[model samples]
Target: MVTSIILINAERTKINEVAEKLQEIAGISEVYSVSGKYDLVAIIRVKTNDDLADLVTNKMLAIDGIAKTETMLAFQAYSRHDLEAMFAVGM
Candidate 1:
């Protein structure tokens, strides 16, 4: 799967609504309303890079209150629990 993190900036009044709308979109796995330089974060998982592009450009960007987006493609995933399990396997 192709995974990406999209940092979203929306109209202040519409941040929650934007997040709700994003969660409804296909291929958007998760949406978070956060406090930071960006208003929200969206996690996108798709079958292909082209699918990612289509979801972001055609679906997400077309939303009414979304102003800007910065997309970061994920290269790898690491978690402490997974790491611990791996080490325990050697025991």
Candidate 2:
């Protein structure tokens, strides 16, 4: 599985609408309206890299009111429980 977090800069006054539209797109798992350099953040999960590319290029970029996007690809993840387990193993 491939995961991407897309930070979206939307047109003024269009954050909510843009976020709502993004939720309907395939591969988009979550969307949030945020206060920062970007207006919205979307979490996308796909089966392959090609699907991720298609989602960002065809679906997300095609949405109206979206000005720009920064995509971050996740490499590894460690939860609190995982960290505790790792530390305990060496004890």
Best model per lDDT = 1
**Local distance difference test scores for all models:** 0.91, 0.89
Q: What TM value does model 1 have?
A: 0.85
Query: C-alpha displacement of 9 in model 2, angstroms?
Result: 0.3
Per-prediction count of colliding residue pairs? 0, 0
Q: What is the C-alpha lDDT profile of model 1 across 1-91, one tens digit per residue?
A: 8989999999999998898899999999889888889999999989999999899889987899999999999998786854897789994
- TM-score, candidate number 2: 0.83
Tell me the spans in candidate 1 whose CA falls farther than 4 Å from its real position.
Answer: 80-91
Which candidate should be chosen as best, given TM-score against the real structure?
Answer: 1
Judge candidate 1 at residue 79 and give its lDDT: 65
